[model samples]
Target: MAQDESLRDLYDGCYRRLVAQLYAICGNLGEAEDAVQEAFVRAVEKPRRFAQVDNPEAWLRTVALNVVRRRFRRLTRYRGLLRTAAASTPADAVPGLSPDHVTLVAALRQLPLEQREAITLHHIVDLPVREVALQLGVPEGTVKARLARGRARLAPLVREFAEDVEEVDHV
Candidate 1:
């Protein structure tokens, strides 16, 4: 296939899934969309030696994962600056999130990054364990382990939230 056709095919096939994957990792729709777009740009800039790869979907997933990771790292480093900038300017501030959403996000933030990534990819994005393993470049067992542990950790947090709600109801 010609380069344009190949790129088009890759984009059509992978864009939605890649965006979904990134969203699961980042927990922010806008950031996920941006990361996927950046990944596509990078892929187009230097076409992968596609002839050597058996599964292009897997390759695209790997690239997308790397893009998200890099973006996350960059965001971490500049978070202070970003916070300061946001504080100084009310123009771009996002509206407040629901308390339930905020609580869930805070719980997710407490998870180890790998466990959180695996849980989100599996539960939120509905990706199969095998596909998530491939995307994360880990063994299937590792993905399973992470998912199990993450769920175990989250269960109590959710229960605690529920208990707090019940207590509030009685007060």
Candidate 2:
């Protein structure tokens, strides 16, 4: 009973923030919510272990991030095997997100998963490079390289977006 109550409190406090973080990482709201929810469910399945954690929220975030990564890997494999099958796209943009936000996320989806993770954590989530490295379990130099590569890939897309905005303003 106590474990359940504490877990409930943690969920109420961290759910939205985790979802937003994961959404930025994954570029899809539904997948983000599902990942976070899966993390909580895992906590419920191992209450004693969860209670032993010193930083429950961080632990939850790690679990959710792992869930997202695993799903992406599995999906990639599935897609590779189904190359001849029709590709499905997300049905619509998330409501309440701006057009620029949508465009940026679409561009982000083009990045390799590692680079996308680094860029999202460092830039979108505003974590320091050291912290991003820690979260990703990569060396600082690797994180730096990923960030550089991601930025290089995104530069043209962002410049095009800016040009479109400028043209719209001029008209």
Candidate 3:
């Protein structure tokens, strides 16, 4: 198959799953989708290598993950500076999404960085421990430790949201 056509087929086959996995990492639907899409755009620049890859899905995923990781690292470093410099617009107030999504992203943002990445990769993204460790370039035990800590910290935050939901339902 011509490289371009092959890449198109791979994109058609993999886009949805990639976005879902990325959504776990990014905590925002638009970001997840956009990151995956952009990865493919970059892939087109090297269609020959992309076509020669044994597992296009894995290659695409690694590319997408790298993209997200770079962005995460950049944002982590910039978050405080941006907070001070940027406008104080509320995400929920921006419209087009439920308040719950905005709240969830807010809570996710408050998590310790390692914990957030571990939980999202291991749980929400549905990667097994070995894969998570591989993707994170960490020891398997480290991934486990991060997941444990992340879950423990997240429990109270998620519970608070759940309690709010229950109260609303009962009202």
Candidate 4:
């Protein structure tokens, strides 16, 4: 009964202030309120633990902040997926990307899957050869060989494409 009263007192005393602080951090009144409410629900779910906290308000604030951060991260990932799915072509997928980047992507598609993966991870994704090998579950030497072959195949294709672009520009 005392624990329940303490929790009730904490809620009545801190709810509005916590929501205001969260609103300032999140810039959305609804989200801030929801996060603070969720924190209180969590506290109710663990009354004994909540009672043990030295600063219940700070604990609730941290929980609310974590909730906000998690939602932000999830929303960011969702938006990235939406952007990727909305574009039909690679060039259309990322605006402001250079022509060379588009050309590189097209050239990458022409390589065999293994070589393409190796080159993309090592050069484009900027992972080291060892890291690429680990990700691909292959030997470092294999990744190196794939990168070498991929680069060999791409050089001619890229050079020819660049020459064509240069001629067009000149005309």
Candidate 1 lDDT tens digits, 37-143: 77667667677675456776666666766777887778667986677532222211324546665556556656777887898788866879998898788999999
Provide the global lDDT of candidate 2 against the true structure: 0.86
Tens digits of per-residue lDDT, candidate 2, 1-171, equal 887899999999999888877887788899999999999999999999999999888788889999999999888888789886434355245887777777787778778888888888888778899988888889999999999999999899889878988999999
Top candidate when judged by lDDT against the true structure: 2
Per-residue C-alpha lDDT of model 3 across residues 15-46, encoded as one tens digit per residue: 98888667656666777788898889878887
- My TM-score estimates for the predictions, one after another, are 0.64, 0.87, 0.77, 0.49
Provide the lowest-lDDT 10-residue window in model 1: 85-94
TM-score of 3: 0.77
Candidate 1 lands at a TM-score of 0.64
Off by over 4 Å in 4: 84-171
Ranked candidates (TM-score, high to low): 2, 3, 1, 4
Candidate 3 vs 4: which has more lDDT: 3
Model 4: per-residue lDDT, tens digit, 1-171? 998898899999989877755543444557768999999999999988988898787688768767877886786588798875332244325445466666676666566656765676567546699876766678999999999998999899899888999999999
> Hey, what RMSD does candidate 3 come out at?
3.2
The alpha-carbon RMSD values of the candidates against the true structure, listed in the order shown, are 5.4, 2.1, 3.2, 15.6
TM value for model 4: 0.49
